[model samples]
Every structure is written in structure tokens, then in C-alpha cells.
Target: MRNMGGEQVEEAVASAVALLRTATERDWETTPAGRLEWTCRYTAEHVAGDLIAYAGQLAGRATKAYVPFEITLDEGTGNEDVLQVIETTGALLAATLRTTPREVRAFHPYPYRSANREGFAALGVAEVFLHTHDIAAGLGLAYEAPAGLCADVLARIFPHVQPGADPWRTLLWATGRGDLPGRAPVTEWRWRNNLVVPAERLTLQGVTPAAATDLAAGGDGGFAWVEGGPFQGTRDAAGMLLKAYGAGVHRPEWGVFVLVRGEDGRAVGGMGFHGPPDEDGRVEIGYDLVEAARGNGYATEGLRALSAWALEREEVTSVFATTDPDNTASQAVIVRAGFARVAGEDSGSAEGAEGAEQFAYELRG
Candidate 1:
């Protein structure tokens, strides 16, 4: 997967400051920033505040809430001064992203309650891009961000929004800043960071569409995997995830998760649901561990945690799974995770493996 970190943050901030510098002499205090209620000056200040706040969240390793601090520009601060503040905070965020470990995640209350380094980086760049557009629009200055940068942010945070012909415009529309043909106007929106569910020894890190694409294409999906990792089963699941995302039917919470060992921060396997819960509130799940990582109870622990998490949700009544009848190891893992064998099937003279005999299990809420 493409890197989404300090470099992207710096590039976005530099681009924003460079563009806004041309109009520093304009009356920003009196001009409204695009469709927003805030003036250009306030919007610029907001950008700086967000950058510093995100940096603080990671630096402080805050887990329950924001860092309980804010940045403020002194009274009579000129537009140039505001731009400079933005640059400084942007640099601070970039530095934080560089220093933070890939496994480190801090407080960020969106759809989930935390975000990792790449998540913070994406949010910082997004703030710079969207607000810069606002300020530029208010000042009548031309502004456009790199297409790739916009696309990265979209894939990382705005996964629910379908890919449009133009990523920048799609981002603008997704955030209620503009419009797109055939899509309803966005009156309310929230950017989602992928979910991470904690277990005794593993963290089930939710995989994004970008990561799924890479994994499906024979890549690491940006994770440090154990030897013999991401076996064919994992790759097959990733392909399914990519297909769902491409069809615009993927839900982050109901998608694939990489089982990362907390002790070493290395991925041991993949586990996740096939799709969202159906009308009966039942969802099917699947998992596979690398050969070297199997027989360690990692799969059992992951299944238990993930299944419990699913049951906690009001929309989910049960979690289900299936395996080849002869797969005693997997069946043992599922039984250990509290699933009961509910059914069995056999197909005689079928065309493919899908027609083979299988054992089905379920864990009810």
C-alpha cells in the first residue's frame, strides 16, 4: 500500500501555505469561507488548531479523550501570522507522525474512539486540503490539491463514499462542500477511521479498502507479517473484500481485520465477517493464520474477541462460520470460542470445492 504519513502531511501543508500566501494582503476577517459560517481568518486558525490537536493526541498517547488543550492566535494576529501558525503546527504534526510507532494509536472520537499514525496523517492532510479550499474560495484565489493525495485521504477515512471521476471534487462533495451528479447532497458526514478490537494478546486491526487491494494483489497490505503469513485463505478473503468495496457495498466494521500480535506488533493472521449482518441479524465470518503462527491459540482468542464485539452491537444477533468437515483444528478453535456446531452438509459429485461437505457453527448473542 502507498505510504500515508508525515511526507503527505508536509506536502499538503506546504501547498496550502504557498497558495494562501499569495492573498495574505486581502481582508480575510470580513470574507466568508465558501459555504462555511466561519470567515477565512477563522477557518485558517481552525486548520492550525486541528493540526496541533492531532499532534498532541499522538504525542501524549491519549486513549480516552482529546489532549485537553487548544491553540489560539493572539489578538490582532495578521493573516500572515495565521499562515505561519499553520505552517508551524503542520510541521509539529508531521514530526509526530514520523516519531510515532506504526502500532501506536491514540484518542480520536469518530466512528471509532482511536486512530493510528496514518489515520492522524490523513486527517491532518484532509484539514489542510478542505480548509485551504475554503479560504481560497473566499479570497478568489485558485486552489487545487494533488489528485493522489485526495484519493489517499478518501480511501483511508472516507471509505463509504464511492470513488468519483475526480477525487478532489468527490472529497469536496463527500464533506458537504460541493455537489455531485446523481448523488444526494451531503448534509451530514463523518470520516471513519478503521476499527481496532482488542484481545488478550492480539489487536484485530480493521483493514481498509486500500490495504485490501494491496493484499489481494500479493502485497503485505502495509503490515509487518510473520513468516509464511497471509496464506492463500487470507488472500482470498482480501479479494472478496476488494470486490465488495468496488461494488460500494463494503462496511468497515463488517469487513476484514488483521490479527496483530500485541507483543511484537506483527500480523499473525486475518479474521472477519463475510458481510454485514443479514435481515435475520446473522453474519458469516472466516479466518486463517499463517502456518508458522497457527496452533498458538491466536485464532481462538481472535474469534472470541471479534465474536463478542459483534454480539455487542444491536444489529448483530449471531456470528456464524463454516469449515471443511475434516478440519479438526479449525473446528476446535471455533468450539473453544464458544460456537456450537449447528448444521452439516454434504454434496455428492459437485463441480468445485464449494460443493464439498462442510460443518457450520454459530455463536448466538
Candidate 2:
């Protein structure tokens, strides 16, 4: 997947500003922005404010809440001046994205409490694209963002939304800004940033569908991996994640997570659930580490953290795993993570011949 970062933000801001400039002489203060109660002028200001706010979030390294501040234009600012503010703020956000570390996360309250640099960049682009569309609609002007840019934003932040034939329209519909064939109009929506869980020596970074697609296609999934890392199992898991996303049943938190080392920010392994908890409140997990990263207990620490995170949820009563009988290293990792080996029917041995040959383990809440 393409990295939707500073360049994309700059591109989006430029496109929006160029188009809005055409209508600067029009009555923006009185014209309502499409589907929004705010007027075109106010909406333009909002776009600028969001851009700067995202920049602030990343630059300040805020973890608990928003940096309590807001931008206000000078009294009697003109439409052209508003556009200038948008440009300035967009540049600020782009610069911030370029400098923020990959592992750094800051406050953002949507489905998750924090967002990384890419997440903030995606949000910045989304704000510019959607709100620019609104302003264009109100002014009776034409506007459409680049299809690739639209797809990039969707894959990163709108992972829950099934991709449509037209990414731009899908984005519009997903945000309650437009409609689609055979699908009910969206009345409420919130973009989701991928989840991150911290362990003793690693962070389990949730893989977005975009990253999953790239990884499945032999790409790096935007992670810096240790040499000989992201083994075949990680790619296979990413393929499974893409399949679930295509089916519109992929719950991001239940999808694949790349194990990133805290000290150097390099991905060392992959670990995640097969899916959400079943009706019996049991969720199965799988994991693997690169040969170069193994024997250091990274897998054990990651498994312990991820399993505990899952078990803490009200719907999950047990976390399950199964390993090949000959894979003693993996068995040790599981054992170290507090999973107990199980036998008989409770071990899922009756499921099939395959199940009987593997060692089943469970960590109960």
C-alpha cells in the first residue's frame, strides 16, 4: 500500500485550495456548505483548524487528551485570507507527519483513543477532501479528489467500510455525505484508527486492510522489519485479514497485529486472533517470529500481552491456540504466556484429523 503521509496531505490541501480559490469572490459567509449547517466560510475555517489540530496532536506527543487550543482568524479576514490559513495549517500538518516517529501515538478520540502519524495524515486528507466537497457543493462548483488518495484514506481509517467500485463515492457515502446503490444511506459514521497494544518489549500494532493487502502481496505492510523478518506466516495471516475485510466481517481489533520492537521500532513478528470470540467466548490466536528475532522471549511477551488484552474484554472468557506437535519453541512460548495444554473434546480434538495432531492450549479468564 502507498504511504499516505505528508505528501498526500500536501496534495489534498493544494487541490482543495486551488478549487476554493475560484469561488473566493462569491458570498461564502451566507452560502451553506453541503449537508452541513455551517456556512461555506465557517467550513473552510474548520478544515484549517482540523489540520492544525492534528499537527498539534502529533507534535505535542499528547497521550491523554487534546491540546486545549483553537485557532481564530484575525477580525475581518477575507475569503482569500481563509484559504491562506488553510494552506499554512496544511503545511504544518505535513511537516509534523514527516518528523513524527513511526511508533509515536497521540490523542484522538474516535473508536480509539490515539492515532499515529499515518492515522493523523489520513484524517487530515479526509477532512480536506470531504469538507472541500461540501464547500464546492454549496458554491455550485465541481470538485473530486484523486481516486487513489480516496482509496488510501479509506484503507487506513475507514477499514470497516467495504470498498466500492468508486472509492470517492464510497468515501462520500461512508461519511453520510452521499448515497450508494442497494445500500442504505449512512446516518452515522466514525473513522477508525488501527489499535495498538503495548507489551514489555514490543507493541502489537494492528494491521489495517491496506497494510494487510500490501503484506499479502509480498510488500512490507509499511513496517520496518528486522532482517529475515515478517516470515511467510505473517503474509498468510495478512491474506486472511484481507479476505475478512473483503467479506465486510473484519473486526479490526480481531485482525492481525505486527509485533514491533520498542527499542528500535522494527517489526519482529506477527500475532493475532483467528477472529472474534465465538459464542462460547473462546477466541483462537496464532503467532510467529522471524528466525533472527526468536529465542529472546518476544513472542512470549507479546502473546501474554495480547492474550491478556483479549481476556479482559467482557465477551472473551478464554484465549486458545494450537501448535504443531514438533514445534517445541512455539509450545514453550505459549506455556510461558500462561496457556495450559488441553486434551480430549475440550481441546477441539473432535473437530477433525488435523485438530487431533496438534497440541491445543487455552488461557482462561
Candidate 3:
């Protein structure tokens, strides 16, 4: 749950610059960057450009698109000057990350239209790490970024990739930079920023595998929780999410989401799918709120938003849930969210429930 911003950007940039400075005299303009057509010099410039651009996004708070400006070196700028540009740009990004509030999100065009501070920081780190490897390979220099740094980057941005024994290698393999045993070669890839679904009073923020791991391990999962928040059920759901991620079957959008109250940005609960939709396009969802946040109807609002989002997807036809027969509050929440009750024998809940008699509910598309 540590913050993955600020000084981390500086560290990544400094590491890359230190290594590249040693080979500044080499013919960077002619040598191609690893697996890319761009020259090593061009690749290095791209890294600096991305760092500055991400910094600009956070600083400008642009929501609809990238800011209409870019960095361009002088025509005669040397390799050493380029390295300086990277250092300067890296400092800007680090400063921006430190100043941006945790709740702020800006434009980033990957799987989502926007990314938070952590997302931009991770992306900047990744650009530095991966491109450094490319330039080193092209220059015949040994290249190995710190494993912890690589792991942090993967957890934040590469949630779709299952963790491997060596984080550095796993990152390379995930982005088609290398290969791994027992997995298909990655010919195409993209880093997915976590999705944020806004509702009237709550925002269901998609839980990344990294957050799930932290939550399962008794941490806050990087969220500021309300007093008496993130109840036992939320922790249990995070454990389930961790398992699903480890098995490489967790679809991020269909996994756990923490419900953050809009007024205070304090997390009140957890809610999301049991897994992806079944063959019948049916997906089971579960949720819970802390004692202090319960009566405010946060659960109902989150369920309504999340269920509506799922049902709108072409792969889902219905959403389902189950509660103890006596848990009338939960039943009311589901009912208010547009779910209808069904007989246990006719409900999908018949297959499971820890052997307790359960009331089933369904919200069909």
C-alpha cells in the first residue's frame, strides 16, 4: 500500500540516465533499440517526452485529451544534453506526483480515458525501465532494473499479467520483450489503468491485483477508509480477488471494487463480481459496508451502479446475489437496486453458499 509516486520517478530516471551516460560516445543514432525500429537515441528521447507529458497532464489536470504541447530538443543537442533533458523532465514529474492529491485523475489513453496519480507514476517508471533495457541491449551493456521497482510497476499497470518468480523477467515477457515457460508469447499487449465508475454518492473504483494483495494482507489497499470501514467481508473478497489474479483468470473490470464516498473520498465498502459472467451471461456479485457507513444506503447505490455497468456489457445478461434468509437489510438493498427474488431451487445460488440456506436475487438485463 505504499505510495508509488514522487521519488520513485526520480529513482527510475536517474538509474536509466546513469547507465546511458556511460555510453554517450557510442553511435546511438545508428543502433536500433531492442525489438523496435527506432534508433537508440530516438528511444531515449521518447522516454523523456513521455515523462514530461505525464507531468504536464497531472499539472494541467486535463480530462478530455493530452495537452497540446510537446518537448523538442535542439537540432544539435548531443547525447549528454538529451540525458540532462530526461533528468529535468523526471524532476518535473516527481514534483507533480508529490503535489497532486491522491483523488485527482487526469487523461491517459490506454484501456481507460483517464489515470490517477499512481497510474501516471507507474507509467513513467515503466517507460524508463523498459526503454533503458532496450538501449542497453542495443549498446551491448548489461541491464537489470531493481526487481522491486519492476514489481511495483507491474502491480500498478500490468494487473492482467500474473506474477512470475522474477518480476523483471515477467515484465519483459508481458510486454513482448522476452518469453516465459508455460505461457503463450505476448505478441500484442497494453497496460490497463484501473477503471473508476462514478455514482451519485459513491465511486466504485476497480481494485487492481496489487490493491487486492495489500487488502488481503490486512492493509488499507491504498484507500483512506472511513472509521470502522472495510469490514471482514471486504477483506475476504480481496483474498478471493488475489486468488483469481494468481490463477491468471481475473478480468479486472469484473473483479472487486472499493466503494469510496464522494463527499469525503473515504472508502465505505467493497463490491463487485464473484467472477466473470458464466456461459449463460450470468455474474454473481457480493458487497458489504462498514458498521458506521451501513444505513446511508451506500451499498444500494454501489450495487445499482455496478450492476448497471455489468448488464450494459454485451457479455452479461443478468447479475445475481445471495444473502442469508434472515439478512433482510441486504435483501432490501438488492431489491432497491432492481433485483428480484427467486426460489432457491431455481436460483444459481443453489450451487454454493457455504451450506447455508440462502435467498437468491437476480437483476436481469
Cα-based lDDT for every prediction: 0.91, 0.93, 0.91
Q: Predict model 3's lDDT versus the native.
A: 0.91
RMSD of each: 2.0, 1.6, 1.4
Model 2: per-residue lDDT, tens digit, 1-365? 58988999999999999999998999999999999999999999999999999999999999999999999999999999999999999999999999999889999998779999999999999999999999999999999999999999999999988888899999999999999998899999998999999998899999999999999999999999999978999999999998988887889999999999999999999999999999999999999999999889999999999999999999999999988777888889999999998885664432323544788899998
Could you give candidate 3's per-residue lDDT for residues 89-192 as a string of tens digits?
99999999999988889999999799999999999999999999999999999889889989888888988888888999999999899999998999999989
Which candidate number maximizes TM-score?
3
Q: TM-score of model 1 relative to the true fold?
A: 0.96
Kindly give the stretch of ten consecutive residues in candidate 3 with the minimal lDDT sum: 344-353
Query: How much is the lDDT of residue 16 in candidate 1?
Result: 97
Better candidate by TM-score, 2 or 3: 3
Error of 2 at 66 (Å): 0.9
Model 2, runs deviating above 4 Å: 346-356
Candidate 1: list runs displaced more than 4 Å. 344-353
Candidate 2 achieves a global lDDT of 0.93
Could you give candidate 1's per-residue lDDT for residues 260-299 as a string of tens digits? 9999999999999989999999998889999999889999
In order, how many clashes per candidate?
0, 0, 0
RMSD of 1: 2.0
